[model samples]
Each structure stands twice: as C-alpha cells, then as structure tokens.
Target chain A: MLLSIKNLHASINGKEILKGIDLEVNYGEVHAIMGPNGTGKSTLAAVIAGRDLFEVTEGEVKYKDKDLLKVPVEERAREGIFLGFQYPVEIPGVSITNFLRTALNELRKYRGLDPMSAVEFLKLMEEKKKLVEIQSNLTNRSVNEGFSGGEKKKNEIFQMAMLDPVLAILDETDSGLDIDALRIVAKGVNHLRRKDNAFLIITHYQRLLEYIIPDYVHVLFEGKIVKSGGKELAIELEEKGYDWLKNT
Target chain B: MKEIKTDTKEIISKERMIGLFEKNREGLFMTDSEFMSRIRKDAMERFRELGFPTTKLEEWKNTDLKASLEKGYGYYLHPVIDVDVQKVFHCNIPHLDTAIIAQLNGWYVSKDVPLMELGNGMILGSLAEAFKEYPRIIEKYYGKYADFTSSGLTALNTAFAQDGIFIYVPDNVSSQKTIQMVNVIHHPESIFLQSRNLIILGKNSRISLVHCDDSYNQQASFANIVTEVFIGENASLDHYKLQNMNNDSTLISSVYFNLEQAANLESHFISFNGGLLRNNTRILFNGKGGTANVRGLYLMDRKQHIDNHVFVDHANPECTSSELFKGILDENASGVFNGHVLVRRNAQKTNAYQGNKNILLTDTARVNSKPFLEIYADDVKCSHGSATGQLDSEAMFYLRQRGISEENARMLLMYAFANEVISKISIEPLRLRIEDMVKKRLRGELSVCEHCVLHCNTPERPLEFDIDVTKI
Candidate 1:
C-alpha cells in the first residue's frame, strides 16, 4: 500500500472538517475523489500534505509503512509527496527556475545523493517545459507572479512533472481552468503516470474525468467516503449528484 | 526645555581645532584665494557657535547623541599606525570593474601616488589636490548647498576636514566605469575624523559613483562626512552610498545635490550594519526641467539606530522629485525617517512624491516615519505616505506550504520585499553583487574577511521561536 489513513479526524479552529476519513491507496492507481462544495475535499488534500493549518485530532496516516503524521512538511515533500496548490502563491523575486533548482537540490541532499549538474537540470527543465506546454518566459519570470489563472494552474502541473512525486495530490487543479487548459493539465498528469506512482485528485466536477481516466472513484460527502466504486461511479454521481449518495 | 549645553568637552574640542589650525597655519593656503579662506572662516565661526545638535531641538528629538557625544573621542590628524592600503582593505569586489579610490583616516590614499585621470577628460583624486588645482570650480559649488548654521556636524566637517575624494567630469564626457570612492577607517584608538567630498558633473556629462564607508575594529569612532554634488544642465548622476561599520561606530553623513536645468539625479543609500547612523540628504532644483530621485534601504539588528532626513527643494518650476525609503529593523533596533518636500511660490507644475515603509520584526523594534510636504505653489502636485508593519503571516505560510523550510521561506519573502528597492539599480553586476550580499545577510552567512574591514558577519545567538510544526 502506498498510503493508508485510518479514522482520520481533522479540524480547524474548534470546527471539525474531516470527521472520519478512512482510505487506502495502492501503487499504479488513479483515484478521483468527487464531492460537493464544502464537503472536506480540499481539507483531505491538506491533511495528506501535512499542512499545519488543519489539526489532526485522532487516527494516523502511514506512507510507505512509515508514520507520515510525524513528518515535517518539507520532509514529506522530500519523501515524494507533492501537493498541487489550488491557489499557487506568487513569490516575487524568486524565479521559477531558481525555485525548482533549489528544491531539487535540497531534496537530493536529503537523500544523500549528488546534486544535479546545471546542464542536466536545464535539460530536464526543457523537457518538462515541453511536457507541460508552458511558455519559455515563465521559467525566467518570478514564480507565479503576474501569471494568468490558467498559467498558474499549468505552472503547478509543470512543477509536478519536474518533481515526479510518488504520491501526488491534485487539490482542485481543474478549478478556474478553461477546457483547453484543462486538457493540457490532464495530459501533463497522464504523461507522468507510472506503475510506481499514484494520484488522488480532489475535484468537484466530473468534467476533468473525460480527459484522464481514473481506476477508482470515491464519493466524499460530509468528511466521509460514503460510496466507493469504479470509474462509472463518477459519471453516475455527476448526473445524480451527492444528494443521492447522502440519502442512500 | 533643556538648554543646549556647551559642555567642557566641546570646549576642549574647539580649542584643539584652534590649535590644529595654528599648527597647519603656514600650509593652510589661505593666500591662494580669498574665496576658499572665507568659506573656512565662516564654517569655523559657525562651528564655534553651534557645537552639536541637542535633543531639545525638534529635529534631534528622537535620536539623542549624548551617548556618542560624551565619549570624548580623540581627534586624529592622521593615521596613528602605519597605513598600508593593501593590508588594511583587501576588498576587491569579484568581477567589479571600478577605478577604486581609497581613503584612510579621512586622508586620500591613492594607488597611483598622484591622481587617476581617464581618457574621457575625467579627474578622480584627493580633494586637497583639487582645491589647489581647480580652486575656481571648487569655490563655485563647495559650500553652495549645505547650510552651515543649522547642522553643526556639517559645520564641523567643513571647518576641520582636510582630504577626501574629488571627481570632476568635463563637459559632454561620461565616465566609462563607475568610480568607487571607498573610505576605510582603521584607527588604533577611539578617534573622531571628518571627511569632505566634492563631485562636479559638466553639461551633458554622466558619472556613476559608489561611495563606501567602512571601519576595521570594534572600538568606538565617529565619522562626520559632507559631500556636495553639482550637476550641470542636461547632465545625469547616479550615486550609491554603501555603509557597513562595527556596532560601536557612529556615522553622521550629509549629502547635498544641486540640480541644473534638465539635469537628473538618482541617489541610493544602502546601510547594512551600524551603531547609530544618521544621514541628512538635501536636493535643490536650481533650474527648471530637473528631476531627482532619492531612495534608501537599511537593515539593522541589535540595538542599532538609523535616522534619515531628506529635503527636496522645488525652487524651480517644472521640476519633479521623489523619495522612497524602506527599512527592516530586527531585535531592539529603532529607526526614524523624516522626509520634507518644499515647493516655492513660483514653482508651478512641480510634481513630488515621498514614501517611507518599514518592517519591525520584533516587539521592541520600532520606527518613526514622518513625511512632510510644504508647498507654497498653488498648481503643484505633491503627496506623501508612510507605512510601518510586520511581515505578512499569510505570505509566510504560503511559501512554507510549497515545501520550503520555514527559515528559507522567511528569507525568500524578506528578499522579495528588499528587492523592490534594489530592482531600481540600473547596473546589473552591481545589483547582482548586492543581491548576493543581501541573501547572505538574510541567511546570517556572510562574515567579515580576515584581512578586509569592509564587512563582517557577526555571529549572533541562534534566534529561538516557539513555532508549532503542527499549526502555522
């Protein structure tokens, strides 16, 4: 198992969000978590990413059989956990290339490995740029500064492609993206899918599933996975909505 | 109100000055021309009257110089120890192509043994030599802008100052490489020294100068500096002052700019470390169609204090001026920014703007920012704004969520805030060097060179924070 969560209850400022979330994921699988508005979809992603904003009151998380709850955020990232932010931050004066290079070197140092050479890093960046179809100017510009909404989302997926995390969480990556941009983002995610990697995409709509197929679909309503099924479940929920799942 | 006390120490200082004047009276060169003698005399009398500014005065209310003034610092006419330029300061900025002029203990110490003259008809040498050679030009703009009566520090510098930097750019000539006037104070004892600089830009000419003040030891010292810049019509000048000294040093520097018709001036003040740093900057629009931009950035920690006072006189119509100053105070450091923009009655269509922003990192860190606009002209457009706040917690959390360590995240955001001021640097290499220095500073990695006295990284006790890894 790549990730295992048992009765995970999280809250924010004395208000509970994820009452009890128990989920398990295996390698080489794509899980689409479909939910309604304010159904703890983003909170689940933040919990998995070890975001300090949410307090985990009970239960535990295990990543690759280690106690993931005790890991720091940056250490989690170095351990191959990536979170694609819903609203990417604009870090002025830090170019995208510099940020990525620094992150990569830090991770490499943590793993007791030699850092990537400048030429090799540039080549990898070139390949990832083409894979994500981002403008060349973005590599030179500040990270997400003055970027359009679509460009910001595209930059997130581009970073995912560069980092190549083992467990990647896409928290509303489909939001605020046009159809063309959606296709580009899905295609970038699909190109990076491998047997050793898994994805848990948290999104509200089923429009994104048309491009990238998921093996399993989970209906997350009121902080719990009320229903779990195959890919067609997303289509079924897209038509019937979460009301049917909650009532059932 | 407490009266301005003429202490016994000040009297001794004045008597020492009179004694020094009598000692150098033969070589005083008073007979060279009456123009130079009158300036020295007027400045001497003023210094006799107003010894030093007092806290009772409204201008010196925030910063009390009593701690620095009562030290009874010894006066030094020259370096008490052997002054070897190479051994004292071995700072050669990597890849920086500057014709460096060195000054030790307020005396010009050059490498060429005389003066440096480029093919572009520019002169860079000792001010004492310039006074003997170009006395006419020196007399025309020497004591033109600085008011000797109000600022006793300026009067002291004008009266007792002997040697400093002097650069003269001929008409229609531009300096190829930026001239770096580096003043290094490495005295054996706690000393007091005054230095003066005179810069002249001819019509349609240009010059970029990087003026630096550095100290070697941890002993206390006082540096009183006065620089006068005369910009001819259509000429442009880029001036940058880099000040980094030991925490036991006190520096009082006054810079005056006189802008002619269609002339432009850009001045940047970057103060990295100091004990008590005070800068009085003044810009006068002597003719129409001129513009001046003055900006400053100061990073201070510990018990450091910085005071910057700027005044831009829009005495001519159709002139534009702006001032932007930003400072980051950590620990118990305090700062004050007083900016005044004056537009006279006949100065119509004068556009002026002033801004001062500060970030106090700790609870005891404080800043006093006041932006004043005194406009007598009816048709002038002028505005001023001042803001002081802490770093944005949201911005910090946002960066940390990207998997960057907390320390690195804070450093990145701080660098971003500081880059807003450094981004205006037109010179790429210089900007890059400054950016690198700032990064090292933010990371607490930069340290003083064993041989160089320009900058040192004092090892501070590790800062402790009660940060909850489980909660931001």
Candidate 2:
C-alpha cells in the first residue's frame, strides 16, 4: 500500500471538519475523491499536507512504513509527498524558476543526493515544460504572479512534474481549467504515472475523472468516506449526484 | 524656566536648552570667525534663545532630542594616532567620474578626488579649501538656506561643523559620473561630530551625488550632519545617501533641497543601522516646473529608534513631488515617520503624493506614522497615507500549504514587502547589493534551509516549477 489512513479526525478553529476518514491507495492506482462543498474534502487534503491551520484531533496517516505526521511539511514533500493547491500563492520577487529550484534541492537533500547542476536543471525543466504545455514566458515571471487561472493551475501541474512524489494529492486541480488545458494536464499526469507511484485526486466534478480514469471512486460525506467502488462508481456518482451519500 | 520630569534626563535637557538662545544679545549678528563665523554665531544665538524644542512644538513633538544633548557629547576634532583612516574609509563604487571626498572624525583628510577634470566651471573640494580658494561662493551659499527657527539640529550642525564637502556644478555642465562623499567616524570616545555639505547644481546641468557614512570601531559617537542642495533652473540632480553606522552610534542629519525653475531632483536615503537616528529632509520647490522624487528605506532591530521627517513645500506653481518611505522593525525597535506636504496659495496645480508603510516583526516593535497634506491652493492634487501592519497571514498560509516551512514562508513574504521599495531603486549594482544585504539580514533572523540558500544565493539565476496534475 502507498498510503493508509485509519479513522482520521481533524478540526479548524475548534470546529471538527474531518470526523473519521479511512482510505487506502495502492501503487499505480489513481483514486478519485468526489464531494460537494463543505464536505471536508479540502480539509482532509490540507491535514494530510501538514497545514498548521488545521489540527488533527485523532488519527494515523501512514505513508509507506513510517508515520507521516512526524515529518514537517517541507520534509514531507522531500519525502515524496505532493499536494497541488486549488489556489497557488503568488510570491512576488521570487520567480517561478527560483521557487522550484529551492524545492527540488530540498527534495534532493532529503534523499542524500547532490543537487542538479544549472545546465542539467535547465535541461530537465525544458523537458518537463513540454509535458505540462506551459509557456516559457510564465516560467520567467514571479511565482503565480500575474498568471491567469488556467496558467496557475497548469503551473501547479508543472511543479508536480519537477518534484516527482510517491503519493500525489491533486486538491481541486481541475477547477478553473479549460478543456484544452484539462486535456494537456491530464496527459502530462498520465505520462508521469508509474507502477511505483499513486494518486489521490480530489475534485468537485467527474469530468476530470473521465479523462484521468481513476481505478477506484470514493464518496466523502461530512469528512468520512461513505462509499467506495471501482471506476464505474464515478459515472454512477455523476448521474445520481451526492444526495445519496448525504442521506447515508 | 520650568523643567519637565521625564524617564530619560537627556531628552528633557535638550528640550530645555533651546530656550537659552533667546536671551543672547546678538540676535542675527555674526560672533565667531571670518568665513562662516558670524553666521554660525548668529545661528548659535538663535538656537540658544530658542533652546531645544518641546513636544508643544508641532515639528519636534514626535522626535525628542533632549537626551542626545544631555549626554554632553564631546566634539570629535582631529583623528587620533591609533586610527587607520584607510581601513575606516571604503567606497563600493569607485569608477565614477565625479570627485570623491573622505572625511575622518570631523576633519578633512587627504583627498585623491579627480576634481580638476571637471573643467566646466565646476568646483569640487573640501569646504575648508573652498573657503580659501573661492571665499566668495562659500560666503554666498553657506548658512543661507538653513532654517534656525524650525530646526535646532540644523542650527547646532551649522554652529559646530568643522569640515565637509563643497560641490559646485556650473551652468550647462553635466557630470559624466556620480560624485561620492564618504564620512568615516572612528572616535571611540563619546564625541560630537558635525559635518556640512553644500551642493550647487548649475542651470541646465545634470549631476549625481552619493554620500555614505561608515562608523567603524566607534563607540558612543554622535554625528550631526547638514547637507544643503541648490539646484538651478532646468538642471537635474540625483542624490543618494546611505547610512550604515555602528549600532552604538547616534546620527542626526538634516538635508535641505532648494529647487529652481524646471529643475528635477531624485533623492534616495537608506538607513540600515544606528542606535538612535533622526533624519529631517526639507525640499523647497522654489521654481516652476520643479519636480522631486524622495524615497527611503530603513531596517531597525534591537532597541534602535529611527525617525524620518520629510517636508515638501510647494512655494511655486506647477511643481510636483512624490515621497515614499518603507521601514522594517524587529525586536524592540521603534520607528517614526512623519511626511508633510504643504502647497501654498500661489502654488496651483501642484501635484504631491506621500506614502509611509512599516512592517513590525515583533509585538514589542512599534511604528508611529503620520502622513499629512496641507493644501492652501485651489487647484492641486495632493494625497497622503500611512499604514502599519505585519506579514499577510493569508500569504503565509498559502506558502505553508505548499510544503514550505513557516520560517521560510515568513522570509519570502518579508522579501516581497521590502522588494516593493527596493525594486524602485534605479541603480543596478546598488540594488543588487541591497538585495544581498536584505537576504543576509533575513538569514540571520530565521533558520533558512540549506536548499533555500543555494537557490537564493545564485544571483541572477532563474528556476522552473512544472505542474503535471495527472501524476499527482
């Protein structure tokens, strides 16, 4: 198993958000988590990403063989964990290239490997930019600064490509993306998927899932997984809506 | 005379002493020497008559100097035998065509400046040398622009100034490079040092002046400096002053800029260190079509106190002025910013904008900002604003959610805030140096990751971030 969560409970500002979330993902498997607003989907992703704003009241998150909670957020990323934010921050004066270089070096440090040379890093960046279909102009600008909605989302996917992780958490990455961008991003992700990697895709619609084609579908209702099934479950959930999970 | 009880005795005495000036018999008459002796004596008499200003005085209320006076700082005359002037004086930019003046302990040392090549009726030399060579010009502009009524510090500087730089750019003669004046303070003993600078930019001529002060191996040294700038009609001047003194030093500098018709002025003041610093910049738009852009940046830590007071007077019509000052305060540091824009009745169509912003890194740090606009004119566009806050919480959370540590996230946000002001700096080399200094300061305060240092230290290098959502 790539990731195992047992009875995860979390809260924000003393109010419980994630009551009890139990899930599992295997290598090479893409699990799509679909839910309506305020169903604690984002909160679960945030907690798993180790955001300090939300406190995990009770639960255990096991990644591989170690307890992921023991590591810091940056360390988690260095340890092969990635989270594509729904709204990426704009760090002015810090160019996109500079931010990624720092992140990549940090990951390399955790793995006890030497950092990529400037020549090699640029070569790798060029190759990955083609995968995500991001323009060269955006890479030279400040991180997420002055970027359009689609460009920002595409930039998130671009970053994931730079820092390849064992477990990738796409938190509402499909939001605000056009059909062309969606297809390009989906293709980029599909190309990067391997037998050693796994994905936990979080979205509000099944349109993204139809393109990415997850192996399993899970319904998150009020923070806990209410139901789980194979790929056909996503089509059923799209047709029936979230009312069935709400009543359950 | 009634004495006000205060926590600091030094402050109270400075305030009460200004009143002593009024009792002197010589109101505006000369009393001390030949060159500026009379003017200095008259100014001293005025200063003594007025004593030190109190909080009741509108301008001096925010900045109290009573403590500085009460400390009884001795005058730093000539340098001691143990001092190495060369080690104490260093110029970061040396290739400029303009002359360079180096002063040590309130005295003019040997100058290797290339003033003779500036043959277009330009006179760049030591103030004392100018007094002997061109006494007429020295007497004409010296002590003419300093205001004794409003500024006791200016009066004190004029009265006690020993040696300084004197620059005169003749009409229609544009300087090829920037002139530099380096002030080196090496007095270890508690001493008062007064330095004066006079810059006269001729009509239709352009020049750049850069002044930097270095306090090396100095303890308890007090520097009181006054720089008077006179820009003639249609002339342009770019002035830069950088103050990076020792933490134990105290500095009180007043810069007076007088602009003529169609003249343009760009001035930048950067203060990075000082125990207690008070800077007063007063610009007089005396000519029509005159424009001034004033910018400042200050970083304070420990118990340092930095006060910046700016006054732009639109005395003539159709003049424009813009002022922006940003400060970062950490530890128990305190900052005071007061920007006043005054547009007279006849100065119509005067465009003025003033902004002051500060960031407090610690709860103990305090910032007092007051931006004011007094427009007596009918047709003028004037606006002033002041804001004090900390790092944006939303921005901080956003960085953390992306797996950056809280410390690195804060540093990034602060760099952004400081970059807003630094980005406006036009000089490329100086801007890069300032950026590096800012990064070092941030690293000293925060636990920056090694990877971050590797990425940020690679000057001018760019990085790339690719996001492929399908994989993750």
Top model number, lDDT: 1
CAPRI band for model 2: acceptable
For B15-44, candidate 1 gives per-residue lDDT tens digits of 666566556545643444577677777887
lDDT of each residue in A103-175, candidate 1, tens digit only: 7877788789898999999999999999889988889999889999999999999999988899999999999
Best by DockQ: 2
DockQ of each: 0.33, 0.36
Show model 1 residue runs off by greater than 4 Å: A244-248, B1-33, B44-51, B55-58, B78-95, B111-121, B345-351, B357-359, B372-402, B448-472
Q: Write the per-residue lDDT of candidate 2 for residues A6-48, one digit (tens) a residue.
A: 9999998999999999998889999999888899988888887
Error of 1 at B182 (Å): 1.2
